[model samples]
Target: MFSFCWPALLFLPLAAFPQNAAPDAAGGHSFSNPATAICAAWAGPATDGEKMRRFLEALTLDAYVSARHGGTGFNWRDITSLLARVERICTAEPARSLAEVWQERKTAWHRGSWKANTVRCREILAAGDCNEDAFFFGIWLYAYDQAKDGRSEATLQTLPQGGGAMVWEECERTPDARLLDVLRRMQGK
Candidate 1:
């Protein structure tokens, strides 16, 4: 009996560990960089939808701050490129490179196609159909939650218009707390 149980006991601790636990992929959305860290401070515990919004928001805020300092504006092309980098870091897909996904997302954005935008994002999360992957699922949840809250429009508008960079020149800036509050409520905290 001890011999039979030994195998089970040996594997019990391993079972408690996450099977997919791997180090975060290098590049894109790492917590190492100062800018990413500032953005992540608000994003760490956020839901999937919140993560996506925050990711998009970071770009907008960066542009806003840059422009406020009298710098040139950021273009959609450049912003999309940055997002592509983020996509690469967030997932482990070989096909459909983040750059490609970024372009697809841009196309949907220009068409004013929310469904397409959502579908694209969902694809990014799953990297394919019917995926149950944790990271993808998490980000998808963020998008879904953001949509349900009716805050996407406000966020979209807050971004610079005409593809130019936007800067918030104000010395003091705060993230939209309502969004964060909703996230906390969703998290049951």
Candidate 2:
């Protein structure tokens, strides 16, 4: 004779599973677009340290790709430095949302004047033996920095051809393969 309670059998599988599984089953969180994912993670509830670190690393890669697409021939040192700075800032202000902290940083820099920043960007471009790539990279970085500084969203809106805006718009529109690569490498997958 076999006696099985159907309700108990049904409940068995559910009980074996974690009651509070992470929102994202594949990972703690997942998104088709890495940039959007990073931004969302930043704005979302508190996450584990490892996850946060991975997000920062991905953000660094995204920024690097964005700059390169704009034609900046930045050295590894520069990229690493930027990553470290951003990580430090974000780490220190864990309570603040990423958007809020980013806005605050932008405001701090914008107070210095967008015109001056733009001029400085040009000077940096001119000082170097800039080729077409370098020139575009400079423009992209300038626009991105200005946008971050809260100078004007229009800078992002109307950037000239081969500028940061172009790359940014593309990133926003679709998932960047390079970004996925970076994430995969970070995850050791």
RMSD of each: 18.6, 19.1
What are the clashing pairs of model 1? Answer: 48-142, 49-142, 49-143, 63-166, 64-166, 64-167, 64-168, 65-167, 73-165, 74-165
Task: Write the residue-wise lDDT of candidate 1 on 54-165 in tens digits.
Answer: 4444443333333223222233334435554544443444233332333333322322111211233323222322222322222223333444443332223322231111
Candidate 2 yields a Cα-based lDDT of: 0.33
Give the true-structure RMSD of model 2. Answer: 19.1
Which 10 consecutive residues of model 1 have the lowest summed lDDT? 163-172
Please provide TM-scores, in order, for all candidate models, with all chains considered together. 0.22, 0.27
Question: Runs in model 2 with CA error above 4 Å?
Answer: 1-25, 28-97, 105-125, 130-142, 145-189
